[model samples]
Target chain A: MRLTTARRSTLFAGLAIASVAVLTACGTASGGGDSGEEATELGDYEGSVSILAWPGYVEDGSNDPSVDWVSAFEEETGCMVESKTYGTSDEAFSLMKTGDYDVVAASGDASLRLVAAGEVAPVNTDLLKNYDGIFDFLKMQSWNSVDGVSYGIPHGYGANLLMYNTDVFPDGLTSWSAVFDDAAANSGKVTAYDSPIYIADAAVYLMATQPELGIENPYALDETQLAAAVELLKAQRQHIGEYWSDYLKEIQAFETGDSVVGTTWQVIQNSITTGNTEVVLPDEGTTGWSDTWMISSQAKSPNCAYAWLDYIASPEANAQATAYFGEAPSSQAACEFRDDCEAYHAGDADYASQIWYWSTPIADCLDGRTDVECTDYAAWTTAWQEIKG
Target chain B: MSSAATPHVTAGVPQPRDTPARRISVFLSQHARVRLGLLLTAPLFWLGLVYVVALAALLITAFWTVDSFTGQVRTEFTLDNIITVVTGSLYQTVTLRTVGVALLVTVIDIAIALPVAFFMAKVAGPRLQRILVIAVLMPLWASYLVKAYAWRSVLAEGGVVDWMTAPFGGSSPGYGLPAVVITLSYLWLPYVILPIYAGLERVPDSLLEASSDLGAKTWRTMGSVVMPMLWPSIIAASIFSFSLSLGDYITVNIVGGANQLLGNLVYTNVGAANNLPLASAIALIPVAIMIVYLTAARRSGALENL
Candidate 1:
């Protein structure tokens, strides 16, 4: 027993030294809030610029020969574009800390975090000639601006619509109730987004249906309101066929008739050729994402990055990129360049204001109510797990 | 008897060696301790630096927490993450579900593997045995994701399984826990079969013939003689299928409908939640379970066999 105790002590000392080494080696960079480097001056473009974006964004005609935007940009500016696609905003936020990429198309869920962590800098609107053509509504918002300073230029936006099979809802339904209150009618055939951000969708419905609950902003839920939303989600869990984070899975499920009605992205609806599906923005209003092209604070080739951003936001490029990505263009002038821009409700400021865009939930109430302590993203994550169970 | 050779043997002068290797071999034969140490140094360094350090770092991070908004790790030590993981009902439920699925997969794979292995070992002609072995290994050549997608189509509502059972008034189980089990069993069956086949080969035919000569039947001989020797291989096979199924997140996602296992929980905490501390805590569950399984396996004399 005494010998074993001596050996155990030796092992513990070794483990202590090793752990200290690990902690010091992999220490995380501190959280963001600093004013980053000054805005870049437009001049001769650098040789290369790397970009991080969502899957369909920044396509260089590699995946499909017809999709060729980056190649043209490279030829036009002489700045070659190397792009990487991330699945979720959380992943994009984490990768931005590396400071390897020149610019990233970050969604609202990650944009604020990037700003707060000092990973991205405020944009100088004067550098771009086309800034005036962009919609005013997406220019200065809570996600893209801090204290009236614009940190990024808007890219594109899309809503999470209610897509239902005509075979299931023959009478043509029109509310979030088809997936929430009246979900049992299609039990085990409903699908929703598989992310903690999706909790806001439930809160949005409650804002309309259960007005007594006083849920003004879906992103800002105090304990009691969050509990109500969680309970509602738990009830809906029984009817969920699956929760999909990827558009391919959602498309496949819809095509196979495994999912009859639930939340869907515009891209998934477009990809479904067989199913007679219709998507409607419920009267309760839906959740959406407006991505911003924010340059990295430690961008090595700042000139190239700025040039790429301006080129992407230009009329013809914005039209092609947004239409290909299945979203509304950020600039109004891009509408004339594309035939179907009006159909996507591009730059429809009134319609855009009605949608609740995704934002990182925090302890402080984002709805401007200072009284109650709101639940944050971490809590939503844990609660989401519990709801799934 | 040349005078030069005689002088070298008598140590009047040293004889030249052709290469450093020859001199080193002669020196090593004289020093067994040095030879043993040199043989073990590389493997020990590799194991200590990679496996032990990574495991230790993971456990240490389990005690830390991340700031929710920043998604940055704070080095302050606390048991909160571990406590939450242990006390939470969701963790308990998912743990039970994962273990149940793992056990079911192991049973299914073993049931399918044993008879096939037996036939290959004792009954099949040489050519047939070679063909059977190739067939078992052929599925592994295809990508894991491709096979998972194939299963997804097979288990869909109007899929092959549904079409096959249509005349019997039955339907596919349709993407859920059952589908997960069936796919996992199919993926890991080759792993189960090869080890058991090797173990059965180790069983001498003379022993089986002797048992029969002593009036014992096939099942009795298999029960008394063959099973005792095959126990180690069976445990080895269980570890592969069990651990693979236990930590599988991708298969569950492709065809598991709305259900999640421990792997999904860890993945969610890591990627979507961005809570590395919680993810590390959740990851410890499968590690602990696997350690217990391996220890139990070692007690059954399987370690040497593996």
Candidate 2:
């Protein structure tokens, strides 16, 4: 009975996906028809603007008395700010669909989905004085734009760095092989980011070591490429101490010697009280996020949204927000205000180019390959479960 | 009707006034079944809407699929998610691991609680019993996250466990499956202990005395009399620990050391992947297990105590 049920379910799943492909094509075409027009010019500021953002992006001194960028913007623009924070990109996407928020800070993974769903409007860069001051490398990427049409202004960016114990590697490591090829050296002490997206990290490693795989983009993987990446991860899993989704868990693991090596963000590294750990961007590069500040298509206060976007992109506000969040500021001018800009490799185009910013994987290959279908996020999710098992 | 007709009182005591509350009370007394239904309506409605309806929706969603790019739920029917969840070796392995951890937690709690509860119910003075119950309940007042983190530190290398064990040339278990089991067992211990304590309170002292008078030794009396009577409560307590452990993901993440459970699979699909259909399908494993478990427990008369 169980065997029959399993076989029937698999058959049904295949049929469902086949039917969904046709439905999705029609849905996207219709969704595109209603793409809200971008505001051509800014008018009088609306009295209030509702903002949805990641935590620490729009602080108004409520969390800390010192972090008060939103207050200054509200005073200067005459647009009262009411900010709500979302925990994940998926959450931001869902919240934007309500058409309640005037502006949102969306990471690359979410920005494209917002544009595809017609939840955000195209930006008129001419209206913003600070648009030119932002890094040239950060703008008009596939995630933040479609067919060269800019969806939003770049906010900030960061990479997932390889962190290791100073005691474990006295000479310091330069490659991700410490966590991939030589991971067994730290057997039961190795760790990795606990998400399907982390598969890209493995792909990044594979690209360097096994160049014959013809893997162009970490996010774009055909079935064979994805399977190869999965095999590498499954091998790494044998040496893994634990997979960590929470930063505090990772920090604790590192502090108590539970995890000697793993993938981590710069912010997590800075938060570690113990001085035994150091982070490095491996030679193979790493996956990272470049967030964009977008205005809602159904925004009630488009003018206020415009003003908030421009204000946030300005050097001082950008510095304050990015500095608090532990990421590279969007503009070189913003780096002048912060002392730790060097640590984040701010304004380094070469360093930025080495980073493959996170873009949601879809059926249409991100690398622009049309000959074969690339594995989507759903496929990765299934594969991640299998890898851990 | 007679009371309404005769308004004036013949006795010295004034006749009771026919207030709105009194009128409703009189009507309710005349119709016991109506009163019973009225009393049950709110609770029954809540159960149907929140529990039954939500469960049905989850099951329905399990048969659906989501658009990979847009993250929207497509209502098109498919057997794919259910098939993947059932046939996938990942799900099977996680299910077995989760069940093993849950069973171990339940058994550990039963072992610890039986002695602690027996002392609280039979040996301790009434004041001490109250204090012991309060002590057992105090940890529950603290947040679950705080306790889990506390355990993480205690079980860390060179931590409390290590410090205490070092004198005897032993070390802490460190973070792994053992850590997960230890933390879960501690968290669910109170839930187990209280039910058994309540069961022990119901066991009359006279029964024990009578068994002793009938030439039954202490061990014989406990095995022949107390064990059979306490069986239902023990089963009820096991259900709490077992099910809670089975559905847990957070504790495992914090301390399991490279492990994932059924809850983690469901959580990742829903939160990270945004595949609600897949998550719902994965969630069905624990629900199905619980149903099978509850059926077995019901045969032991544990459901009545619960």
Residue range A1-389, candidate 2, lDDT tens digits:
24588899998677556544544444312232256897787789889999999999999999999999988988898899999998777678778877799999998778888887788899988898999999999989998988888888999999999999999999999999999889989998898988787899999999999999989999999999999999999999999998886777898889989899989999989999999999999989999999999988889999999898899999999999999999999999998889999999998999999899988778899988999999987788789888989
Q: Clashing pairs in model 1?
A: A32-A116, A32-A117, A32-A118
CA lDDT of every candidate: 0.89, 0.89
User: What lDDT score is found at residue A252 in candidate 1?
Assistant: 87
TM-score per model over all chains: 0.94, 0.90
lDDT of 2 by residue, B136-221 (tens): 99999999999998999999988999999999999998888999999999999999999999999999999999999999999999
Say which candidate scores most in DockQ: 1
| Highest TM-score against the true fold, candidate | 1
- Alpha-carbon RMSD to native, per candidate: 3.2, 6.5
In model 1, the runs with Cα more than 4 Å from the true position are: A1-26, A29-35, A40-44, B1-42, B304-306
Displacement of the residue A96 alpha carbon in candidate 1, Å: 1.3
Clash pairs, model 2 backbone: A241-B257, A242-B258
Model 1 residue B147 lDDT?
Answer: 100
Instruction: Write down the RMSD of candidate 2 (Cα, Å).
Output: 6.5
Candidate 2 CAPRI classification by DockQ: acceptable
